[model samples]
Target: MAKDIPAVAAGNQVRSVAKALMILNLLAEHQREMSLGEIAKEMQLAKSTVYGLLATLRDFGYLEQSPEDGKYRLGTRLFVLGNVVADSWDVRKVAAPFIQSLVDELGETVHLVVLDKGEVLYIDKRECTKSLRIVSQVGTRLPAHCTGVGKVFLANLPAEEVKSIISTKGLSRYTKNTITEFHLLEEELKQVRQQGYAIDNEEIMESLRCVAVPLRDYTGNVCAAISVSGTLSRFEGDELESIVSLMVRIGREISLHLGYRA
Candidate 1:
């Protein structure tokens, strides 16, 4: 009887499926790992029921439980699936040619990054052939406040949201040039917003400079950033300005390709 409609299911079956999906959604929404009790409380479900569902999910590789802390998180299976989905609509794919061009033109390392939970996640990198590049991996995550691309993405958000992110992530010092105070960072972000670009002046690594530009989507929201990094000696006064203009121009081109009109 239920064969005609593929979507049709018994009430109990549908309820079970919904509950399982809700657990997955919960894990996706939360930034940190959660305990079974916390998930049960958050979802208003009984501990026994939640534990059963979580155990089933964990056994199937959809979720993983930490042995040290007894916390649960989305497992590597989801990450594998996410990578598949990510590839289908990857901004890195659209920006690859342009990024390669920047490296070819500037002979410096180029990075494409996006903000993930108040941190910068590098999605793509074009290395300079001249052996003058920053030692950053494609999937490396760094504090958003300490990088030029991170600051570009950060400058696009609201003050309240920015404050919330800062509170959650905290301003941990990485170097002497890294901004550790909220007030000072705010002032720096204000300048970045006004200038339409951001610069990391030996902040992440001593004497390593980076200039970044924002990449906006079709809706004019900043979705990512592109940065060119090299040593300070090669990126001094006039050279720095030239590279900034070139990067910004190329960045706008990539944004347009990603469906942004302006």
Candidate 2:
């Protein structure tokens, strides 16, 4: 028969650490702001232990007490950490010149995007020299199935994760051209993987057309995408092909500079 180890001697420390991490995760998921009693009940931990952890976190500035109700919430430390991560991305540093050159050569708007959860997050953009413009802000997020950059990123994801995301964030149609059906979107993604590029044929906005190429990382994984967007009237046949080639080239260049091989 196996002997049972004492809690204090062997497993108590690990259990305590696990509980503490669970508490932190819960707070983060809830966007912080929880009363002491609420936190203890949610974590299924003793009130004394929860208080000790909260006090320690407060001392370290990882949490703060609400001025009005004495509830606890995430503190400035998280903002400082988030800023550090944003600074590290420094996408503009590497992508700006390429985007400028593309805009000069193709006379179209260029955009850089990264996948965040189920959305395409715009990190950088360069508007065209043309008088007619397609407005897109740097911090804007859009549905993955309806945009060029989003399609490229989604094409590279594993099938299971794609299905999961689609199930959670349903394929909402933004325009008549949008591919809202799950099976149809899957087929589109397969074509993108085979062709090495994606096209947004007025899927997100009427009369707007766009093309995108995957931006890979050091592990040869698609981590982001670069795209060129313009009016459908301006993008047709040979001109569209030219812009697609340029975007693929620029995306590869940026990916390589970011340590991607292949």
Candidate 3:
């Protein structure tokens, strides 16, 4: 057998990758956003070289910039990739029983969706038996501005990024109830961020209403969202609040099961 490599020798084998990992570790330890200058100074690297690495990381969603200070912080994609790595524990499997219970309780369709390039991608659906139920298939992608689940994802993003996404995607009206104007959408999203949930309010489909709650990870970042969608008649007045409360509770419970401590 060949002689065992020394620990230092083994570690030095991939110096570039090791340095990249060191940068990530430094960012994580900082526990706050860092500017490009800050990161480069900490890494003792050339500005251009650090820029290339940061650009690559940002493009891959491993990092994101804060609009307030133009500094970089951990991105939502890291939480997403973490969930993927934790698939042995499996978010879908952990969430299924709760989702099934909710569908039974509410007698409405339930959806689990994740944010994708500022859009919402439906990954799973627990169908309702009602003949008039909303028909959404797994793997369907919808604009983030008008849907309940989509709003939950957007509300967690920084304000400038949110504005950029809307400006690029431009709120194509699906219904009169949709928040088409940037100012109106901005106000509602502020409310959404504060409330920890969002409402569709017949915005996507007339006479259809939805309430969505953020599904968080151990880092307390929203990796996905769960939503309940059904007819307006079922969501009128006090019933609407009731449904939202139930969904929020379910979301929290699911978050706890997904290794979120609080």
Tens-digit lDDT string for candidate 3 (88-192): 536678888999999898888999898888899887889768724675887688999999998898899888989888878889999989889888888898999
Q: Which sequence of candidate numbers ranks them by lDDT, best first?
A: 1, 3, 2
Error at 175, model 3, angstroms: 0.6
- From the highest TM-score down, the ranking of the candidates is 1, 2, 3
Worst 10 residues of 2 by lDDT: 1-10
Please name the candidate that would achieve the greatest lDDT relative to the true structure: 1
Q: Between the candidate structures 1 and 2, which one is better when assessed by lDDT?
A: 1
Per-residue lDDT value at 26 in model 3: 80
TM-score of the candidate numbered 3? Answer: 0.66
Q: What TM-score number comes out for model 1? A: 0.71
Which portions of model 3 miss their true places by more than 4 Å? Answer: 1-89
Please, what is the whole-model Cα lDDT of each candidate in the order they appear? 0.87, 0.83, 0.85
lDDT over C-alpha atoms for residue 231 of model 3: 84
lDDT of 2: 0.83
